[model samples]
Target: MAFDAVVTDLDGTVVRADGTVSAATLQAAHALSAAGVPLLAATARTPTGVAALTTLAPHLAFAVCCSGAVGWVPGAPEPAWCELLPRAEVADLVAFLTRELPTVALAAYDSRRWRMTATYQAMRPNTHKGPITVVEAAALPEAEACTLVLGHPDRTPEQLVAALIEGGFDPTRLGLHRAGRRFVEVTAAPIDKASGVLRALRVVGADPARTIAFGDMPIDTTMFAVVGRSVAMAGAPPEVLAAATDHTASVEDDGFARALTALL
Candidate 1:
C-alpha cells in the first residue's frame, strides 16, 4: 500500500446502513492491517457505541469516537484520550435544551461509558451499542458532558440551529454537523473526527498525504478535506461529495471495500 494508514468514518462509511460493518468491509480492514497499514475509526459515535467492531476488527490501533471527544487506543481497558464538556457548561446547556426542546436527545461521554437521556434511550434501536445502561437524565451526575445531541424529523437540523441561536445559545463552544437528513449531532468545538485523526497521525508519524479517508455524510467532510485523497459514498450529501477527491459506491454497495482494494 502506498499509504501508511487508512482512517474511516463509521456510521454510513464503513458501517452498513443498518449499523453493521459488512463482512467484506471488515475483511478489507483486516487485510489493510495485515499489510501493516493501521485502520482508524473516525466517527461521531461514542467509544461504547463503536465497541461492536472489536468482535470484527480487533487489531485496530485507535478509534475516534463521539466525533473527536473520545479516543480509545486499541487493547487498552480505558480511553487513551478524552475531552468532555466543561463543568460549568453541561448543566446550563442541558437545562436550556430541556426547556426549549423537551424531546431532544442528549449524550454523555467519559472514559468508561456513553450515557444518554431517557428520550435517547428509546432511540437506541437506531444506535449501534452493546451492554448499554439505560437511565434517565435525572439519574446522571451534574458534571461535564462531551456533547448534546438533538434530532427531529419535523425540524431540519438547520432550523434547529437557527432556533438555538435565537434562544440565546452561543455556538462558540459547540459543533454542529450533519449525520443524515433526519439527524444532526452537536459536540464540543475541540472534538471532531478530522482533528482526532490528525492527532493520531502525529502520534503514529503518518502525514495526511500518505492517508486516505472515506465517508458518506457531512460530518465526514472535515476528514475528507484533510486527507490527500478522499472517496465519498455515492449517497453522500452535496457537501461531502464536493469535499471528496472522488466518488465511490454507496455503503450498501461495498464502496469502502472497493476503495480499500484500490488503495492497495
Candidate 2:
C-alpha cells in the first residue's frame, strides 16, 4: 500500500532504553518528511512528555497524547482536541480504587498539568521532571482529568489490571490499559491510540488505508486495528504481535529504522 503518513509509539518502539531516539530512527523521520510523508507521535504520554519529541524531530508537529484523550502540536498553547473524564466519575473511581488497593499510587492529569497523590509523588526519582503537583486523591473531584494513572511498585502491569478488575472497575466502561510493567492507565471509555491516530489523520487529511503505524504494546492495538499496515516490534506482547500485519526487529536492534527503510 502507498502510505501518506507514518505513526509510531514512543517508549518501546522508537526510543532506546537510555531514553533517546537513535540516529537511524532520526534519519528515517527526516527521510519521511523529505518525501512528503507526515511523521506523527502516538503515545500514552502526557502533553508534557510528548513535548520532548519536538526537540528531537522538528518534523513532528502533531502528537496524540494521553493514549487518545488529547491531541496537540508541541509548543502550542492549547490542544486541538481533548476528552476528559467527568469530575464526579473521577472522584468515584479514585475513591473506589484507593479503598480497594491501598498500596497503589494514583496520578491524574488534565489537559495541561499532572497531579499525583503525595505517596505517588514520593516515589518519583530525582531525575523525574518537575511541574507535577502533589495533591490528595480527594482533590481529584476538583480537577477534570483526561487520564488516571495507577502505579504499584510491586505489581506488574498485568497484575495491576487484574486487581482493578477485581476492584470493580469494568474494563468495558473505561479504557483500562497497561502502559508498561509498573503502570496501568484508565481513560474515558473507548479512547485509545487509534482514536488519537484517527483524529490526527483527520487533522492532516491523511487516509486511514494509506497510513502505516508502528507500536509495541497492547494500548497500541487500537491503532493497529485502524491502520492499513501495522508493524509490531519483535519483543511486543504475543497479542500485539498477533494483531500486527508485520513484525520488525526489537527497538534495541533499531527496528523502527529497519521497518521505515523497507516501507519508505
Count of clashes, each model: 2, 0
lDDT of 1 at 183: 57
Structural similarity to truth (TM-score) of each candidate: 0.88, 0.93
Q: Which candidate leads in lDDT? A: 2
Tens-digit per-residue lDDT, 224-243, candidate 1 = 86788988998777878998
TM-score of model 2 (CA atoms): 0.93
For candidate 2, write residues 1-264 as lDDT tens digits. Answer: 369898999889998777888888888888888888888899887777776655454768589988898998867878888899767767778888778778778888888777888777766443234367888888876878899888877878888888777877777778888876578878888888888899899998899899999999988999999999999999898999999999999999999999878866
Residue pairs in collision within model 1: 44-67, 45-66
User: lDDT of all predictions, in order shown?
Assistant: 0.73, 0.83
| Model 1: CA > 4 A from native | 126-141
